[model samples]
Target: MSAAAVPEWLAAEVAALSGAARAGRLPHALLIHEAPGAGGDWLAHFAAQLALCERAAEAPCGSCTACRRVLAWQHPDLTRVAPLEDSRQIRIEQLRDLAAELALTSHAGGYKVGILTPATR
Candidate 1:
């Protein structure tokens, strides 16, 4: 991916998170709150890729195998949660599923991202 595709602020946050992950000081969960168009989902995806990227250099190197899978939405480690098509609000069951997923270790020994869009309650 090109630099222009990522915003400056997000790039910096990704760098910081990458350092924490490499140093084994990253948190188990991160709660991100933002407006509809604030790019929260994109940011979460970026973090997941960065965590799983084999050649992560303070950022996700999109050319890596892990990065490719992540970009393709086929990474086994990345989990995205959103409201169901038939529902307007996030259900408790969704959060429960996410909790179960995060309870286990990452497949790639990296972070397992749970991106909850417009968190409910």
Candidate 2:
């Protein structure tokens, strides 16, 4: 279970987020606002993986047990909230579920990340 090599764009973001995490300055809730096809969701998912990765490095090592799960999209600590089929908006119920997941402890002794994508109408 190793993390994949973080993309350059994602690496930069992780560097910033990692600083915040180290300083205990990260917000409890994160809202990623971006236009369609902007790879906004990808950014969110990469950030989530960095938060959960167990490898030791300035960035994710992509070789730790936790990293592997993240790369495989099986990390229990990462949650993505998006619209359902036939739906045009993200409902409060889905937000609640994300909140619940975030409230729990990380399985790998790391932070749990709830990635909220672009808000729909």
Candidate 3:
């Protein structure tokens, strides 16, 4: 989604994150808590894009190759964790594997991003 499309309620958050990213002061982890369908997942992806965007000056441009890859869930440096089929919750093994994956070097030699969706489950 474009920066122009950010909901008013989330604009502040996006700006803060963008500023942090630009300043290289982003935290190691972020917890985005929101009600169902409140755009938590969208924000998570935006954060990832902020970290992995090729244009540091205009991160999360939403049009660059890195941003596009992240939107398509095809970026080698991006790892998504969710419950497996037939499971209502993420298994311990999945978390362990995610941890291991995050520990490895980034394929792009940049930030490695891991997104855990449906975290409320």
**TM-score for each model:** 0.77, 0.71, 0.95
- Sorted by lDDT, highest first, which candidate order results? 3, 1, 2
Summarize candidate 2's per-residue lDDT along 1-121 as a digit string, tens digits: 1235445555666667767766757666566666776666666665665567665453355667666676677888877677888777788999999888888887767788766655656
- lDDT (Cα, tens digit) per residue for candidate 3, span 76-108: 999999989999898889999989999999988
Q: Roughly what TM-score does model 3 have, to 2 decimal places? A: 0.95
Off by over 4 Å in 1: 1-4, 56-59
Enumerate residue pairs that collide in model 3: none
Best by lDDT: 3
The total of clashing pairs for model 3 equals 0
Q: CA RMSD for every model? A: 2.5, 3.4, 1.1
Query: Which residue pairs come into collision in candidate 2?
Result: 1-68, 2-67, 2-68, 3-62, 3-67
**Backbone clashes per model, in order?**
0, 5, 0
lDDT of 1 by residue, 1-121 (tens): 4456787757776667767877867666667676767777777777777677877564577777788888788888877788999998889898899999988998988667777777745
For lDDT, candidate 1 versus 3, the one ahead is 3
**Following a full C-alpha superposition, what root-mean-square deviation does model 1 have from the true structure?**
2.5
Model 1 clash pairs?
none
